[model samples]
Target: MSDADAPLSATPRTRLRRMSQKGRGDRGALFEVLRAGLVCHLGALVDGCPMVVPTVYGFDTTHLFLHGSVASRSLTTDAEVCVTVTVVDGLVLARSVFEHGVNYRSAMVYGTPRRVVDAEEKLYGLRLLTEHVAPGQWDYTRAPNGRELAATALLALPLAEASVKTRSGPPDDGVGPDAALGLWAGELPLVATWQQPLTDPALPATVAVPAHVAARAGTRADRS
Candidate 1:
């Protein structure tokens, strides 16, 4: 079985302390959250300064892959990094403002990312990244050329040390004193859907939109 298919063990860094009730120890939860989200925020220390950068990411069974231009300062370093992906599901409105919260599914991964150097792996990583963002687009478009590959940098971070947390349902004050207040106390669902594809104006009239791209229109962006 692939690493992704295997279970995950919580590390010291990944263990949740504050909201232990929401923490998920299973590997499947981590993989599910990562697969549903499109973008990830990468936190790292660069030149003694802390930086968090938002970037596109992809994953296989064992590792998460991040890619950017070779000139990008964030991708060039060997420092340890924290990657997080979150999907907001709804807004929890309570009787009190302080009790309000957001319903979300999130995952945090910690590790020192290794820069990908193998030609074969690099290409494979790129393909995974592309398909993650837009399924079936990789096979439809031309593969990356040598010049493009040389300019790009890919980094792989192990998915071993990670934490997954999720919050759902209604406000927590349903049985509390705040429930006495005559205010709305429920969840306002938040959803994202893809709109119809807009074709390039410069494209030939005969060049039609591919089925895979066209089919995604009006579908949930976070669908697994």
Candidate 2:
């Protein structure tokens, strides 16, 4: 079976304990949430204290890749960690403040990340990471050389143990007593768009913006 066709199982650490109705079991859902997001919060224990770092990430069918400086303490630790990605679609305005919620898709993965050392795999993983943030960028930019690669660190975390949850649509207080108060209850959608690219002041005026970069103007930033 193909990696795309394989199913994702919720391990003990990933199983949803609250708001279970929003939990999604399909592997595709997890992939969609991850693909729609560019930033993720990595939670780990450093020196016996909880720490969460916001970082960029990339993922394939089976693994998620994270990169940082070689001296990063969080990436060097071998302990189990959690990575979470959330994309907020909108705000759910309800009649009652207590009933308000946000329209969002979120996913959490738990595991110990394995440090990547192979030169070929490291380059491949770095390419995936670069393309994930800016599509078509890998072809337009120069690749990293040996000295730069040696100073970088990469980690691979499996997607086998993960869970996804999503919430959308209008507010849920329509049938409650709060509805009689005549307050507006609906969704205020959030949309993210890319603005025009700005050229560096030091660059020569003859230098033109690349097609891949210019084409993204006014396009949705969150869509894969």
Worst 10 residues of 2 by lDDT: 1-10
lDDT string, candidate 1, 15-63, tens digits: 7889899987778889889888999999988778888899999998789
lDDT of 2 by residue, 1-224 (tens): 66544666857877789999999888888889988999999999999899898999988988999999998888844898999999999999999889999999999998899999999999989999999989999999899999999999999998989989999999988988888998888999998999999999999999999999999999988884
Give residue 1's error in model 1 in angstroms: 9.0
What lDDT does the true structure give each of the candidates? 0.90, 0.90
Q: lDDT, candidate 2, residue 223?
A: 88
In candidate 1, stretches whose alpha carbon ends up further than 4 angstroms from where it belongs are: 1-7
- TM-score result, candidate 1: 0.96
Where does candidate 2 clash, by residue pair?
A: none
